[model samples]
Target: MRKRATAKEVADAAGVSKWTVIRAFTPGASITEESKRRVLEAAAVLNYTPNLLARSLATNLTHQVAVFVDDFANPQKLPFLETLTERLQAEGLVAVLININNHFDHVHALLNADQRQVDAVILFGTAFRNETLSDRQLGRGMPPMFVLARDSQIDGVPAVVCDAELALRDIVDHLYERGYRRPGFMTGAPALSTALRRRQHFIDFWKGKGVDEIAILSADRYSAEAGAGSVRHYLNDIDPAARVDVLMCENDILALGAMDEIRGNFGLRIPDDIAVVGFDNYELGGASCYGLTTYEQPRIEMVQAVIGMIKGRLEPETVTLPGKLVVRTST
Candidate 1:
């Protein structure tokens, strides 16, 4: 087997001590400029890869950030992670993704640094609960955290989120202005803070427009099946006198599903019997069958803002952005 070149060998070639060669690999370590340059040049000539474990132990930093997400395949999360990965890479940092299978337990692991490998954390989830990550932890010796989709009022931690309340209010007003009354609502999981806020704002906005009786359905998840089920529940469960003229879903898939249910199950004409709107505006929501009217989240702005927060422009904390509504065939 070929002998790997060690720090000692690099140091000999550079005319520096092995300790000096080691220092080049350590970030924030006390080392002279000249010595650091010579050590790096020698290491390059020797084709040396620094010992990551050793450097991590010495500097007390892994130069790695952990991003927590529920479903990576979800369209909403993909853009954020891709943008963050690119930004972090430009800064010579590695991003480690932690799949949040179990919310409570997985969140605990991401926050605590028993291994000392993670420098910071980013999450797409709503809020970390008291049992998962407490206020004490937020105030203590915890590394920086960037939370997306929640407010920035968690102690001093930074958050990058879209203003759900404002977005929903805007959407509701747009629909109302378009002469859409008897608005029906298909809301998402109440546990999610953003979802709850959007639902409340949507209802309040409808009520403000003189919509006395509203059709509202609750769904278990944000999926096509849930969307279809919510519509069915609305058609079956509601009183015959109360009819829904406009359907507003909290997600694109749900909107698509509701559109399907409205056509197939109820034999109703879309936009003729009921107009529909959705959030996130997934491609499927804009299918030929269901050109869904929905809000396009400022994906670019949100991504850039989060990158800026990670880049240290906005003091690493939660930042909420706004969204715009687009009309479609469904409406």
Candidate 2:
């Protein structure tokens, strides 16, 4: 096997010090253009690359951000993850995806991230709760933490999330204008505390308009099957004449599933029989099959805010960005 070339060899070939070679490879590091060009040329010739482990040791920063996720079943998470990883890479940072599951919890994920010396930790899923953030043991020696796509009530922990109040207001106004008098909401499991905020916002916005009586339905989990089941049960239990005219779901996945259940099983025509609206404009929501009217979260802007916070370009405070309402045939 051939031995890898070292930075010292590249430095010698470039007629510069080893520190100059390091600066040439480091992002945003001060280095003369000529020196950087020589270092790159020498590095290409010798097949030399700076050791990230060594660099982390010297700088005390790994340039790695730990992102904790658990809700892989939801399709909306895929787009958010793609946007987040791409943005992190663009900022010269790496993302360490940690799965929070039945066996491993948020506290355990926090410990692992801290042990790995990650520059920051991002809670990107519903698995993390405010109680977990308040854990004293997990707080010690922990890296800077932020919440993405969800609101954080814990002080000192900033969050980048969609403006739920504005989204819900827009949704309610649209529904009211469309003559949707009786409104209903479909949510995920009880464990999803973050989703409760959206549900409450939906109810509050409706009540503000004097529509006091709103129906609520909850799924067993954050999946299409759970959503379908919840809709099935609600339809079976409610009288046809008193049923809700419009259903607002916590997410696109639930709305998609509810639509399928409503049409496929009950033979109900969308908008003619019942209108549906959802949050998070997933790709399939735009498809002709579903044509789901949903709210589009400002995913790119939210991810950029997170990167800005990491780079100190923005303050580490709760940053709420407004999203747009997407109208489709479903509504």
Candidate with top lDDT is: 2
TM-score, structure 2 vs. true: 0.94
As for model 2, its CA RMSD to the true structure in angstroms is: 1.8
lDDT of 1 by residue, 1-331 (tens): 9777898899999999998887788678799999999988988999987877677787677878777766443455565567778877877678877776655454466555435567777766543543446534444566676666555444555666678888888888888887887887887654432223667788888888788677678877666888889889888876745768898887787788888898999898889878888888676766677788898777667767766666567666556787777778887
Best by TM-score: 2
lDDT of 2 by residue, 1-331 (tens): 9899999999999999999999999889999999999999999999998899788998899999999888888888899999999999988899999988999988888888999999999888775677877788775678988989988766788889999999999999999998899999998866443433888899998998999999999886778888899999999999999999999989989988999999999999898888999889999889999999999999999999998999889988889999999999998
The whole-model lDDT of each prediction reads 0.73, 0.89
Off by over 4 Å in 2: 27-37, 191-196
- Residue 18 of model 2 has an lDDT of 95
C-alpha root-mean-square deviation, each candidate:
3.6, 1.8
